[model samples]
Target: MDLQTFMKDRKKLVEDALFSYMNAVKAPEVLLESMNYSLKAGGKRLRPLLVLATLKSFGKSEELGMPVACAVEMIHTYSLVHDDLPSMDDDDFRRGKPTNHKVFGEAMAILAGDALLTHSFEVMEDLLNYDVKPIKVVTLMKELAKAAGPTGMVGGQVADMEGEGAQLSLQDLEYIHRNKTGKLLGYSIVAGAILGDATEEQISKLEQFADHLGLAFQIRDDILDIEGDAAKIGKPVGSDTLNEKVTYPSLLTMNGAKEKLEYHIKEAKRILEEIPLESDLLGQLCDLIAKRDH
Candidate 1:
């Protein structure tokens, strides 16, 4: 199948599974509504797609990886919900609609985000039912925790908040994006590799690929903020500047940022070439990340 067709089919599968999983959660009606609100809010299901794509690259069944894929997406959605809270980005819209806190109120929005985060682990436990080894499942769970916890996304977020409106070195900026945006992304690929029974060497190479891909992803995001249309990107352009957040373009200059984006894309694809698996899908994904407008 072509890359576009492959992504469309797998994206639908991920969306269906997300809806089913959210429907199974028993909670107060309003809380569930709040959770489902952001969960259903439209965005590229890139993280989960990465999981299934990595599995497919290794000739594993996508169904076997679905649980992990959904779990990772849940964690991602939860982060967005919290990130839009009054205490954080304070954004009023997401995916072309009111943000969770705006529609559900801040207290319920916070609870909903908490619910998604905790429930992701519960969803991951379902992996045991798929005949996956308990040890592998345990490892994935531990990795997911670390990726989403203090030393990863949360730490990056704290650093990003602290660095706002200040002059930050490129190294420091890279550190913030790698952990804040890259750790969970890296986890998605690594989880698939583990489930697909990748050799240790292949897993290591894929991790390196994911790291570069993650930075490329963030660079594209920064570029979009400058040149993207709100109708397509589903938010106001220039919000980063308005918020006093330092972006790649702001620090490196627009031309320099684009150059860095291309570098990361090339590096990610180069690492993919070194892996033994049929990694064309992953390579195509790297290009997509580099060029995605939203």
Candidate 2:
């Protein structure tokens, strides 16, 4: 499967699934509006793409990818919504629009994040109805919970908020970011492996690729924050520096960050090359990661 097409198509799939799921909610008007506002915010939908494309590489149907894709994006979007809260990163805008907390009240934003986070599991239940083993579903859910909950995204967020303005050591920074940002990316690929019925070896290879690419993506994000076009990135330029957050670009020169990105891209490709049926689209996805503007 083409990575670009997978990303584009899977994103649309997730959007449709999200809308379909939203239709079932019997919440109050104010809560529903707040949830919609956060859910509809523009994003790259990278997590969902990772889940779908990885499954596609294994010749899995788009049907299996749909629920997992939607769930991953829901978890991701929830993270962003909370990240922009006044008590957290305190940003005014997200994906070029007012943040959930800004448009709705902070309380509602919190509730929205909570709802999306838990609703992801409900979405998954609706997705896998046949042919899949119950043990496999339970395993994947355990993995997702670890990656999205306190041991993963939330734990990372804790460090992020605490580390602000503090000059962190290299190890400290890596630990925070690897968990905060990288874990979800890691989870996306892992979900595909588990759901697609990949071998243990195949799962390991995909995990390695996702882990490296996730960090590389975050490094590129740091670079973009310093030098990216705000119009394209949709975030304030130099926001990292402004927040006194420790990042790759802050620790290394522009050329050094570029070198690190190159290093990871090579590593991602190298892993894929070792796996059977690893097509050109997988490599292209790494290339896209290396060259993404936003």
Candidate 3:
């Protein structure tokens, strides 16, 4: 299938899996709603789609990696919910609607983030009931934990909080984006490779590709904050400037930031070419990240 058709089809698949899995939560109604609110908030299912695309590139069925896709997305949604709390970025809107903390009370929003984080494991555990090996399931859990825990996304959040009102170098900024966003993106690619039983060399190439892709993704986000439309982006622009957060555009001029973004995309595509697999979708995704207006 073509790239657009492939993404459209896989998006539906991921959405169905997310809704089905989330709706199965047996918790209190309000908390469940808060959790579901962000899950259904309609951001691009980029991480999950990466999982599926990597699986497909390695000649594995997307269904085999569906559980991992759902698990990663839940972790991502939980992070977004927590990141929007009053003590955090203090955003009142997400995906063009009220944030979880805005619609639900702050307490419920906290619980909802907690619930999503915890329940992602339950969703992952269901893999054991399928045809997957016990060792593979264990490896997946380890990967997810390391990426979302103190050593990864949470650690990045702490660094981000501390960096506010402080002058940060480009290296310091890269460190934050690499951990906060890149770790999960890398894991999604590696998850598909593991599921498809890719060779060690193949996994390494994909990991390198993911690293560059993640950096490019963040740089584009910085650019969008300056040049993008709120309607397309689904949030008011200039938030980074408003919050006094250091960003690529703030340090590098807009032209310089675009140059950096192009460099990353070029490096990512070069690494992708060395992967020795069908990665048209991954290639298209790289272009999308560099050019996305939102």
Best by lDDT: 1
lDDT by residue for model 2 (48-127), tens: 87777777777777578777778888889889888888987788988889899988889999999899888889877765
Residues forming the 10-long window of minimal summed lDDT in candidate 3: 1-10
**lDDT tens digits by residue: candidate 1, 175-271:** 9999999999999999999999999999999999999999999999999999998888888899888888889999999999999999999999898
Q: Comparing 2 and 3 by TM-score, which wins?
A: 3
Compute the lDDT of residue 134 as modeled in candidate 1: 93
lDDT measured at residue 72 in model 1 versus the true structure, 0 to 100: 90
Error of 1 at 124 (Å): 0.4
Q: Report the C-alpha lDDT of model 3 over 218-276, residue by residue, as the tens digit.
A: 99999999999989999889989998999999999899999999999999999988877
Task: Score candidate 2 by TM-score against the native.
Answer: 0.96
- Off by more than 4 A, model 2: none
* CA lDDT for candidate 3: 0.90
Model 2 residue 97 lDDT score: 90
- Give candidate 3 regions above 4 Å deviation: none
Worst 10 residues of 1 by lDDT: 1-10
Ranking by TM-score: 1, 3, 2
